[model samples]
Target chain A: MHPAPSVIVFTVLSGLGFGLLSFLGLGLPQVTGWEAFFYFALAFALAVGGLVASTFHLGNPQRALKAFTQWKTSWLSREAWLSSLALVAMGLYAFAAVFLDISAGLLGWLGAALSVATVVATSMIYAQLMTVPRWNHWLTPLHLLTLSLAGGAILAQQSAVALALLVVAGIVQILHWVLGDRRFEERGHTIESATGLGDIGAARLFEPPHTGTNYLLKEMVHVVGRKHAQKLRVIAFVFMIVLPIAVLILLPQGIVSAALAILCYLIGTFASRWLFFAEAEHVVGLYYGARSAQAVAG
Target chain B: MTQLPETSEKKLGLVIDLDTCVGCHACVTACKGWNTENYGAPLSDMDAYGSNPSGTFLNRVHSYEVEPRAGGCSQTVHFPKSCLHCDDAPCVTVCPTGASYKRQEDGIVLVEEDACIGCGLCAWACPYGARELDLAAGVMKKCTLCVDRIYNENLPEEDRIPACVRTCPAGARHFGDLGDPSSEVSMLVAERGGFDLMPEQGTQPTNKYLPPRPKDQLPDMDVLSPALEPVAGEPKGFLKWLDKALEAI
Candidate 1:
């Protein structure tokens, strides 16, 4: 819940990158030779760059190779495996299209599926956390997937498809916020339940464990002002969804429009992703006398 | 390797008495002292003696004021919290590096410092906030339940327990196998009605907490009214003599 800069960048950039990769794998633009090379280069830069950015937050980036071993139970591990597989598959497909001038039909489809799966796996890293009530919802994955596809469609120059997906993404975002706000109360965690003192009486924090802050307080207990969050939500919606849709409808389809659309979408997604972490209410904060997510949302 | 065993042979955990804890934080200090020296990584502090000091600690004590709903005096409950070492520990399964694992033998959840990638996903998965990321070491640190001391043959037999349990001044901390029905801890839990923290989370924590006893129950009385009541119809011995002398004057 720290709204860590590394994480925000990682999720937004990677989501967009993978979205574009999925489209390219499906031969959405159907370009060959140098034109195909340029698109592939852009996709790889975003995808690989985002992956590298993710490691920046790790305390021990040197040991990150060990992260691939626990894919059986860990979503983070699954994400590592999935992203690697997606990259390799997409790499082969890109090589065939750009250099060999071949479609590599089956490989392209496989790469596309893996690319989307990688994004889902990334989303699961947050969605699987029951500790954060705002993120532990079905809508979390749905929201991310919709945004990724919408961004992908724009990059692929599919204006009609992009417009529809953008509308859907906007709906999912609203639904995510509306339902996520109520999740903490529905989960029924409170200071009393947190301390097992509900049967006796109402409990309030009389004294903290220490005079200064500790790791838990720093990592899990983030406070975002409601007014500020609301403003950001509006900004995200207007730029990420409304503007992209408006541009595709009004401006002539060209490289200039696509660039403007991509830029606006990235800015909006970055803001939304920041809110994603900042607004998440981890149940651990209940022990420190933080109000539940429902109360904070109010 | 991150997958937990179906069942651990023993559920080793602590039973904390809320009634007896004086909020002294002695256990907290003792835990830090013992763990920093003995564990995989020394708990590091940044700006320890300077402004804005912060450090990694395995255990912490929090105090809360509980106002009974039945309308009695409020009570302060000193809560000493650390790793619960849950039977269904989310931390272990969430570890991407296979560093966080629960021992099948003793049910002690531990972090293998060597294997740790310091990704911190385990810390996020834990609802209790038990695991902490060591800033200097870039690895996770948690309550090992003094695994080093408890099993070390060098220590005295009486010292074969968690540092917090051994050092608790009020004897409020109890460490034992909670899995066995006949264990002292299980019996104590049965008698005192010990309860788990955040049962809704379904972590199924091995640790238990004994709720504080009820306070401030007494019958109403008027001490001043009894004192003001007339002892005699006229007066007592000293007052009678004074009244008679006054009448003569």
Candidate 2:
């Protein structure tokens, strides 16, 4: 089925951690205080946790050290190298901020680059998988940006500038989802054409590959109805992407509504990611007579 | 470092004819036999004789019923899937250790099983699902295209072919230098319009499958399957029980 949860947690948690660090990197002279130090510490914690969580998904966790050698051609290797580099940069920035005799300006830019590096590396992992049609999209990068924005906004009780960037990120995320969903919808026909006899209109299947169930039928061909998927998409829109934006917009006025929105976005995004994997159709599934039923109906 | 010449004899590849394949799984069996006998390890069958079982084979035949589109009969497409030994293999790139690598001279992708630690990322990275984990060996294994047989200089020149291609009864499998445009395999591709499995996903699979021929070439199965032969017209046959059992009742 899907990749393990430890990986999911690592990606999401590290996203948030890096977003917070990026804002702290801005280092506005007007804003001087414990808030910067506070956010910095928490962000570093999440980043470290994300790094640790990555190993759980590896079959041979020890061999992960060898990934650093292939940075010339492999994106996965680049991601590993970048993540470790970011980890080091963020630590240096933290030390410079709290205990060292260092200029605030230098500390700020370094933190910013590390934050950006972390998110970019995170996005590259899925984008590099040319085998997966769903993940290899322009929206993949946008998804990371939006998710990071959402994370940044959640931690934005202290800064107006960070809060503003979060709003922009939220809008971009929503647009990316809307556009990406349309692109994915058009794919049913391409998939139908690839497996069938190239006539998009006339393709029909009166039979399946086997009389009883098999792994391909179960794992690839889910009998989950389209109506259910649409409903879930709506839930993802409102709670995961939209609600957090609304909460941040209204947060200066109220407390309870803001708290509720934050809670909703977290749970909603987790479910959306799960659905992302669940609904993905591997072309190997097509060989086993799992045609796009939606394309046929349309 | 020792510098090396990059060019020599042409690297041979397989071109499978989709039109003639009967989907009999003969090549699969032939591959298992040759690999077990000659290769480093035999294809192990787990619980094969006892109960539910499985084993490895270099090639597998998959049969599909293709619906008529733009006025062709509902046809049967017997396409087989395997490793393409690509010029640029994603499976080679993502190997954490330097275990999986493409040959420097030829474009053959291979795994150093000794260095591999049994991670299934190579399987995940391959869009074609070409790689499979050798559960007993605690490492991954895949189609080597009978590398041991074809490359051995001691063998006679006529015997230098992949085992599966050598054993195919229908002559459906063609082996030759795909790099040469005038090669039989290359000309076959030019004549038949060989299609890549998933070009958009774009692993750039080297092996090409010619699209299935028209359904007219297929014999009428309704008449053929039922009319293979009659039970040798004799007394006290298994069919006599049908009449006696019904008469008694």
Candidate 3:
């Protein structure tokens, strides 16, 4: 699920790229009509750069176009299609903004709509896996919103409207943590249900299937994951949520401090997203000689 | 180019009784012996006579302490899980190549070693963790239900079963045509109320397990070793002392 190093870099980099694009799209209409044109063009460039950067992550890059064919079922296909469409819409918005000097109406709304679609599609990639109960939570949608909003706020630090949105984004981040913590907390409970056991849970493996580590154990079982999860939760709660908001509240001056706040929030969100994927345990983990939650206490 | 005629309504499976299974690992050894020779490639054992040596074994006995749900007794059931020969297999459907296919005649999920590109998608899709890629063979390997022996005309009628079943010391494994309702396998399952492994997975596994009976009525482990009489035994040798020291460790 972590994929490869290339995949991790690709996903994280693309997340920042598209997230900033969505924010820029939303922020453009709020600022001066002339400024919207300039930002839209710049954002279009960023979107393409991000898109190309992500292609290096694919195992078979040539077969990637066929991924869109599975859109009727697979969220991955949907993400690919939506990402492409969103790119096209953003590009068209850029063309209209730069060429026709169009600052408002369908062009503006199209960019915003496409941005929203891309965010939803991106989150759906992990959220759609029925086997992975942790990713299938409501926190998925919130993370998507926070991702773009946090990045958009940074790009919008020159103005007060983006600054205000950034604060709202902080509140959203805090809310996500408050609600999202329960998902990780209640993972054991879900596994018990999935394993078809009653209240008599906390099943510890007396012994593993084999003495040495296999693919499942190496791939699925996170030996240091619980600690990583705990550390990341603290990071997300304090660095991502609390500290940024506190900085924004204490510093009343303007966008300079807002930039720092946005930066902290972005760093926090990235860690949060990484943990979100890493912490997600698939049901297949059970058969792979993965000991239940009691293995953690040991 | 295809000439194999498919027969409908055939249910083939390996019936294993938990009551008789001694967990002696005879079937495990037999499976390794047969598959390594007859299958696509030999199951290799690396680092022999060294720190670590490991090889593939299709049949593995999983001994678990299960408390009887209906009855009051609790005993250990040595569960041997392999390819279930499911009616609707998730592993088969998920395979991009037509390599992993269910035989319409017997409903046994078999890997076509020739067609198998070793993509490893089937292994990931299986909930039971049945399919394993034979790295040495450069293909997938699994329990074939003694495909070569079952249909072979040269083998004796009684010995037409899988080598694992034939070599089981405790007579734990049973092989037969499950299509016939009145077959010994079906009758035994009906009488004992045999259960499927991980029915929640919805593989609809053909294989069934006979639940473990009460442990209390069985002879206690404590009664096995009788108290040694205070006999003036012969002088203990160096070998005896070494054996005692090894046992203590």
- The C-alpha lDDT values of all candidates are 0.91, 0.63, 0.61
lDDT of 1 by residue, A133-207 (tens): 889988999899999989988988889888999999999999998899899999998999899999998998888
Q: Tell me each candidate's TM-score.
A: 0.97, 0.76, 0.65
How close to the true structure is residue A132 of candidate 1, measured as C-alpha lDDT?
Answer: 92
In candidate 2 chain B, what residue range of length 10 has the lowest lDDT sum? B1-10
Query: What digit string (tens of lDDT, one per residue) describes model 3 on residues A51-154?
Result: 66656543234545655554544455566777788787777766666667654456556666777777677666655443455666666766666656556555
Q: For model 1 chain B, where is the 10-residue window of minimal lDDT? A: B215-224
Best by lDDT: 1
The order by descending lDDT is 1, 2, 3
> Model 3, B1-249: lDDT tens per residue?
011124437788988887788777788788889888885667666554567645555666655544545454545445676787877576665443455677877877787776665545456456565766654555667789979888878989877888889898888889876767899998888897777655655667788777554455545456635665545564378967886898899
Clash pairs of candidate 2? Answer: none
User: By lDDT, is 1 or 2 better?
Assistant: 1
Candidate 1 lDDT over residue span B48-80, tens digit each: 999899999999999999999999789899999
lDDT of 2 by residue, B1-249 (tens): 011114323445678887787776777787778877876556666666655556555566667565655454666656555677765577787665666776655556677666666556666577665676655664566777778878888888866887778888888888877777899898998998876666665566667777666655445367666677775664375668876887799
User: What local lDDT does model 3 show for residue B86?
Assistant: 74
> Residue A93's C-alpha lDDT in candidate 1?
93
The Cα error of candidate 2 at residue A288, in Å, is 2.8
Cα lDDT for residue A28, candidate 3? 44
